[model samples]
Target: MSSISIAWIALPFFVGFVIYLLPKLDRYLALSTAFASVAFALWLFVVQSPINLQLIDHFGVTLILDPLAGYFILTNALVTAAVIIYCWHSGRTSFFYAQTIILHGSVNAAFSCSDFVSLYVALEVISIASFLLIAYPRTDRSIWVGLRYLFTSNIAMLFYLVGAVLVYQAHHSFSYVGLRGAPPEAIALIFLGLLVKGGIFVSGLWLPMTHSESEAPVSALLSGFVVKAGVFPLVRFALLLEEIDPIVRIFGVGTALLGVSYAVFEKDTKRLLAYSTVAQLGFIIGAPTVAGFYALTHGLVKAALFLTAGILPSRSFKELREKAIATPVWIALVVASLSISGFPLLAGFGAKVSTLENLMPWQVIPMNVAALGTAITYAKFVFLPRGGEAKVGTGFWAAIALLIGGLFIANIAYPEAYTIANIVKLLLTIALGWIAHLLIFQQAFVKLPRLLEGFEHLIGVMSLTLVVLFWMMMA
Candidate 1:
């Protein structure tokens, strides 16, 4: 691929600034930018890349668009398009569009990075852009949660920067390849930062609230694309550190279970999706190739779920039965929910089956349990409120249609996904999930959708996570 093609990374950034200058044309510009992005990502993926050729190279800075980065860019682009459409349809302004579009560029920048310094700067930009989007509602709660997210993200990135410095001091290079030569403490610190930033395990305690509190389109971007900034690089880094794989899987399994436990009891629909994002990320990180595809599956499906939530008049489980929803919204809700639950013929089934295949036989059982919990958690989506407006916004259908199309991605190539055994397993899981929900999960106890309610607690969790990560690496 030509180096000029790499300018695609900066497209959204420039368009986003133009969006700021021409607030009235935000919708048109943003839509063009989002689609053009998806096209470029696909174009890059289709073309052969020279592995040794840097997409961008300069004084102590470098970037590349290898297959791995291409995959992540595609995932981010697909979701950002959906989110951009949903935001415009939902009547968000140019200012909101500016932050989200800029955030999209930041994500692309992050995934393109080949050096720790570049990655750190990209992530910091991501934090600033996401913080703006998170606080868009300007409510006391939105502001507070946004600040919490910003505070945690900044601290995490700061730690990462220090680790990067140490890596350079020891290895005299900032490239990921140099990680193998760096001090163990440096790598541990970097991993800890990524885990927190990516919303994994104890370090990710801020995720549920931060994601749940943001507006739906904003939440979609956060869940679908932003968190990958932390984990996507880790997948590449694992190639350099063989020991990191087992460590990542242990945390992945824990995150999967713990995240679903919170989701099953969540009172708010948005909060449930937030926890599910955490759970799904936990699910996605188990195997490298599977992680990539599963992350793509999740990016599309979760964005649809959040956008579906946005369209519903109801905000909680109980409200679903009582409220009226547009027919399209109702349909989108079921599809997105079922997709996340790994229903047959959907995106989740293929990626998740691949994940299960790659897991240790013993590990498969808990992930299956996590899958079952996912079905149970999403079953509440079925209440299918009382009424419908035939005239939902064009943007809603446009966005939902695009996402639904993305759902079948690469599933056609997976023959195993269509096997009778998997089909039967899915049916039984959903059936059992319904029974469990009817018998017990009835918001049996209010969870505040609660946990990690304070910023101090967030700091505490980060510190504890850092300590454990350090101890593990040192040992």
Candidate 2:
């Protein structure tokens, strides 16, 4: 079983290299490999129990296939498969396909790895591949965005490495399970580093620019899948350090509010979605199982929204209203919007309800506020007037169909999320959001201050956050 798990990690890189050499078959090969990867992950979920594999004795290189890890693996695989199909349909280059496959492999490895060493290696793999993919289009804006992402990622990983070293020195092992009683300093450093990856408010200031500037499909992948790599580990740490749960929850609430506040005022479609990703992640970090479900729904719906943005003639809400979009494209956008807004019977509603069920009464109010804010932000899309006729291809429709199907499947699978009270809450939230949009956003021209727009400013903020966290942990 361990060998099989290792093979799953290796399969994409091996297949990618081969496909890169055979450029003529790149599209077919990439798609086939993606589907096969998803199939293998699902099979493992059904047949396998939790297992830890010690690949190296002295180095403590280990892999874990627990139920929690399995859920992430499956989600990553599904999103990767959809993105590959989008890449093929959009006529991306062979290099793009190769990088995508490599990213898929790295993400799966990150989710399954049992030790800090293996996880760190996987993180590096993902970072390098993502940088290349974000810069793949070679536009001036994209290259600059990619570089910003690379620098921030390297700095965060350095923090993680230092924390991992501290843990190894204290415990003589780098395995997550072995670091049970590690010092607060070590845990704080590790948490701060992962927070940068998770797209949390202060540390993840690099997210909006990077996600909004990348190519549409790449934006989808970054927002929907890549950001979660940082988040999953953070959730694990929170579970391990129960003493820190209160602080994590406070950060989560603040992050959620900050994300939605910025998203509401942002006019750029992709940037709005990017901020929403940050906000949803903030909510998810408070509860792991609910986070898993939320991640799945968010990945699918967010990808679909990004892909839909790509096909639109213009990204400006006012311009989009003036131009005609394809019927299928409009339909896709509507489904994605409702899902993100937590409309009853949709994926977002189910996940939000499940998450709220696990929270304290006060925590529930903020989450509900965030959900309402999300709906209000998305209302612009719903009311945008449609004008010029555009034709969408089979690939676009296929991606949309797959995402919507996933949403329905999520709702069906999580029936516990559909109680009468939750259903009423969902309706009220949407109603409030709609009213807010009309009474506030539509009636006034508003713009929030872009305080974190500069990279240097973001670095300062991240530094300040680390200092504060350290002080808290020490005190």
Candidate 3:
């Protein structure tokens, strides 16, 4: 396909058009659109199409169908596709389908964009769509969350615009290629600006509330893909500039560990999962500074885990917790928990090892401790006993299938050749993590705090403050 021929690849455009034509078809809209979007995005990744261009002058509109963008798009589309299936079954209203499609397309555009202006437009579209999605059900809490998201995101956009202006002033063009000669302070500000979209652990107060309270599938897409939109730009910025300031390390790791710390006290299943997203993103952001390959691994597994969490908890969410105390659901939960904790060879472990291996030993220590903490917090999910079994729902089975497929795909899709050693290590990690959970943490699991009862806004406030302080200092 010619690169420009990708007008059809603008999956969201088609979705938006469909929504306008059939506004009442909310039920099937998200599912059907998601399927179409995923198929197109897959083609975008595989085909040798040139960079998709919409407009060009001194400042052009272009999409780089490169491996980097392909990686993010594939995961983003996969998550949306999985969550759309779950939503179809869960009976969520289709009124938000347009917003979901818009969000998906905007985020996908953000990933593939090759210039600052294009990337900004993509992020802005996603931000507006997310605000709508957050406020879709329009509860008082949803309204509040939506307002917070809208305000915080717009401010971030302003900062990004300022940085864009600075880059344009200095380089005479607004392109990723133009950022190379940009000064350190401008680069740092741009990075911080993008961090808002990424939902860095420190400044991401809007995530848990908006996502956890939104409809489940909305929560899934937001958690699984939208937050990741920020990371792509951050990575691009880091690559463009040569500066290796220590603040990047501090901000990234602090964000990851802080979120994980929040997860330790979080009781709400969805909220806890949201905090985990921050923690996982922390690793991805920090890893690239030290090693290159880890982000790829983390992106795949974390996206899968987020999608799985979003899919689970259809009705008896409350009862599901109670039943989990002594059922087979515990098995599924443990596998996911261990996978996220980097127990050894599971998806998380592969990401962690690949990420931290290249860092200095001392720098590696904090990450290791964070991984251990991740283990402890996730261990709380293992309330179901080893021997008990319960009936599985279609959603439950779907969640299981998604998780396995995610890992399998991650293992295969990685550019590096997979070795038996890696596979063996992953299996070993799963075994040990499970054994350790059963032997040492089983009692603690029973005693863990309830998800909703332990909620606090303190951590969110503190993290936001630190992020601001770091940005100011870097500026």
Whole-model lDDT per candidate: 0.81, 0.80, 0.64
Error of 3 at 36 (Å): 4.3
Top TM-score hit: 2
Residue pairs of candidate 2 with colliding backbone atoms: 323-387, 323-388, 324-387, 324-388
Order of quality (lDDT): 1, 2, 3
**How many clashes does each candidate structure show, in the order listed?**
1, 4, 5
lDDT of 2 by residue, 1-475 (tens): 7777777788889878987789888878777777776677677668768777887584668876776666567677777777777766676778988898888888887887767888888888889999999999788888888888888888888888888999898888898855567777787777777888778877887898899888888888898789888888766656666766666777778788889988888887888888888898887785654567778888888888888888788777767766777665676787789888888778888887878787756787887788888999888777766544787777777777777887887778688877788888888888888889988886556787677867787677767878888887777
Candidate 2's clash total is 4
The true-structure Cα RMSD of candidate 1 reads: 2.3
- lDDT tens digits by residue: candidate 1, 1-475: 4455556777888999999899999978877877777787677667747344343343266776766676678789888887777666566778988887899888988887778888888999999999999888899989988998999889888888888889888877788877886787898889878898899986787898888878888888999989998888787776457877777888889889888988898878898898898898888776665677788888988888888887677687777667677766777888888888888888878877788778866678898899889988988786556456745677778888988888876567466677888788887888898788878886478554344657888788877788888887776
- Between the candidate structures 1 and 3, which one is better when assessed by lDDT? 1
Instruction: Give stretches of model 3 more than 4 Å off.
Output: 1-5, 24-29, 40-54, 244-247, 289-328, 343-346, 358-362, 385-396, 414-475
RMSD each, Å: 2.3, 1.7, 4.8
User: How many angstroms is residue 33 displaced in model 3 relative to the true structure, after the best TM-score fit?
Assistant: 4.1
Please tell me which predicted candidate would have the highest lDDT against the true structure. 1
Please give, for residues 63-138, the per-residue lDDT of candidate 3 as tens digits: 5665556666766766666665555555545556677777888887888787888888888888888888888777
Measured with C-alpha atoms, the lDDT of residue 361 in candidate 2 is 67
How many backbone overlaps does candidate 3 show?
Answer: 5
